[model samples]
Target: MTVRPAWLLPKGQTREDTRLAPVGTWAPDGEIRTRDGVVPGGQPFAATGVAAMQLQIGVGRAAVQGTTAQGAYPIAVDAPETLNFTDGNAQFARIDSVILRVYDGLFDESEQPLARVEIVEGEATATPTAPTLPPCSLRLWDVTVPAGASAGVGGIDWGSALADRRRYTTAVGGIIPTGWGLSFAGAYDGQYRDADGVLERWNATDATWETYRAPEPPVETITGGLSVASGWSLSSFDARRRAGVVQFLGMFARTGATLPANPNIGDTLVATLPAGWRPIVLLEALCSNGYGFGAAAVGGDGKITIRSWAGGNNVSGIEKDTNVRISAAFVQ
Candidate 1:
């Protein structure tokens, strides 16, 4: 039964047969499951305060991967598992870890695929540090035992003494838990993950994770301050801005009781383009005076001035009754 199927167990199959591959299939291998950690969801292996020096771990499931020879092992805690810590060192504090461990007889000379929850006591020193996890084990929590602490006399404070070491994994392509990215390298470019509350994508070239932001609309319409110069009134006009470019389309007609026989080449048409709508350098556009062609210039000061006018017969001035049409675009 070296190459056994993971599912559809036959009637005569033994316990060892299930451990061969059924458990691994139930929890597939991938970036998420192949890593040693709790199978996230529903308070898996939650540790709670119990009597002094005692902690109770709620039922949970986890995956543990050992050497290639030992392969992977899955653990399930159907009932609560209570762990008792050794009496605190009389002179200094110590850190102890609750771990889910797999012991394979083929590799450990013990029961084949034996899984259990156990405590690995830490060394007591002036600055106590947690014990190192052995191979084929997943740490669930770290408990700090202060000096002189005992079950009944000066018991441990569950809140301050317990440090959660549980990490989580999900099905492939699923949103992994926060902090997962900090420990594992991204699988590919454009790989996405939830970083705390923000969505981020991996950048393979830069070897970094960048925040994802939605694209914004590019063009905006200019709504106000398109006033015409004295003796001129707007007929139809539109002004829009995109990036650093500003565009305009409009018709201006002469007004007032007295009108010049012809508009001067230096006469102003638009008084100002308003702040932020001005150009960095002077820009010119060819215009029409209904009867002849001319040119207009927009200065950095926001004024639009008539630069030239080829009135009928190649004249330099525009007829007073002729309407002016200006269509232009410039970059600020």
Candidate 2:
């Protein structure tokens, strides 16, 4: 049986053993198992245009997980590395990728456990696609080489050719970069990320990173056209909005000395909600008028109308000194 311990390299350890020692020492198990990309903070392997066929990669660091036996590896570019690309095809375009590669001698005798930056050339075709990355390689950028592109003849345009392929990762509970989600699927619910300065949480049920929004206090005092009818007076009123639904709560009392005759269906106007508080479609709700029950209709045009009433004398259903409760809700 082979016994190999990480973090501490014992005496007489070979170069290969030293290379694998830092695999688990640098990051936690969850991060090593689930994450592999450019490390956040400094400009990790940032590619900038240098010449028609050349790009300068800035100094940076990254982490990439190899096979189970090889484990994970930390790659660092201490100094900027300039790379050159082959001339583009005369008849068709191609997409080439700049990548950070980890070569393990255990997998291939000719290879050593060394991390290096290299370019993977793509095939020239009518519809050229980026080349498939080999195992233990992380793509940094995709350079689109147009037809007849060359350093001397019809120089390549670096501005339009370079497509950023750099995705970022960090410690297990750290905030990932903006485009990290596009390449990596969230492993569990409650995972958080930074999306272009916006804090977002991964919702497993929805399979998306929903923007985190602070809870807003409900509107205590109602506004807009809220005029009580001639024979009625308001006791209390308030409005609240939550999760795209607006709810109205209030109490109104009849002040007239005599009971009013039951008007036609949808006769009395109670209040008119503002533009944002109005519902997309007309909504109706059952309301209590102290002694009897009534139907309140909320229209799309922001009108609140008393539709009908039941109980009391057949002629006058609403009696004087009675209170009507306005308790309704609708989607805003």
Candidate 3:
């Protein structure tokens, strides 16, 4: 025969004649309190401390008017719902950490249930009856965080091998949509790919994107070699080439003889133009005596013509030795 231990009895039950039963059924002093729905003191059973509490919630049932079962009984039981705690005071309650144990259908050593322990500082609003906990403050589901990194530091790794950041290093060889642009760095600094897959750069001054030029072409310069035409001798000449345009500045002199004041000078080759290029005169001058007056124009043969007049008309009483300089640009 096996002998049962006294501690094996159910709660509020005791051993009498070596048998555990209800409180009043076993002992006269153990009486069930009727008032206040509270248990009476001096029950002889006391717990040291509660280590854990397990609750199995029952499902509500419906009523059926059919055959034998009169009252409704639970037909199907739902999985336990998540427990919620609230103070309903509109204040906040903080929790330093929480440990959650997860299991499959049955929990046992063979099942090896998982233990998820979170150690982040979190708070819940304390309104009135039920408190509400906010969602996680930080989300790092796919983040590759360092081992020793702090919990506060979490983000998607931009330079990670998992990311396709290298796509911007060079322009894609495939076709792209119109007006689509991409900005990159390194060898492509200030450069971008246009909709046509063509590389370009932002021109802040122009407020637009210009075709990117690798090793920009050097500016071209041409020496006119000094040409004197129509009694006009070349004094100095300067020419500069930039992109698709060229500009020239030429000074001419036909002095050593006194002439009428504000004399009108005709047709002069301020400068010659390159083939297929036309010259657009910017400034024409005839500096003689104390004042000068001249006008420049583009001739039919791409030559710059300068004509001088006094007060908009031919004048008399001029000085000796006059200087004429012409500034013009040639564009193809």
Candidate number with greatest TM-score:
1
Residue-level lDDT of model 3, residues 1-332, one tens digit each, is: 11111222234322341342122211110132110011112311111111111112222111111112111111111222222212211244332221111222232233532222122323443321111212211110111222222323332122440111101111223212232124322222253434356666655566566777788667877656543555556777777777667677666675545334335545545455454445443433333323555566655455666565453223453333566556666564
The TM-score between candidate 1 and the true structure equals: 0.58
Clashes of each: 0, 0, 15
Number of the candidate with higher lDDT, 1 or 2: 2
**Candidate 3 displacement at residue 324 in angstroms:** 1.4
Q: How does each model score on lDDT? A: 0.71, 0.71, 0.34
Cα deviation of 187 in candidate 2 (Å)? 1.7
Q: Give the candidate order by descending TM-score.
A: 1, 2, 3
**Any runs in candidate 1 off by more than 4 Å, and if so which?**
1-33, 179-181, 214-332
At residue 47, candidate 2 shows an lDDT of: 83
Candidate 1 residue-wise lDDT, 170-192, digit = tens = 55465556632355555557666
Off by over 4 Å in 3: 1-192, 195-216, 256-290, 311-320
Candidate 3 to native Cα RMSD, angstroms = 28.9
What's the candidate order when arranged by decreasing lDDT? 2, 1, 3
As a whole number from 0 to 100, the lDDT of residue 32 in candidate 3 is 24
List the candidates' TM-scores in order: 0.58, 0.57, 0.34
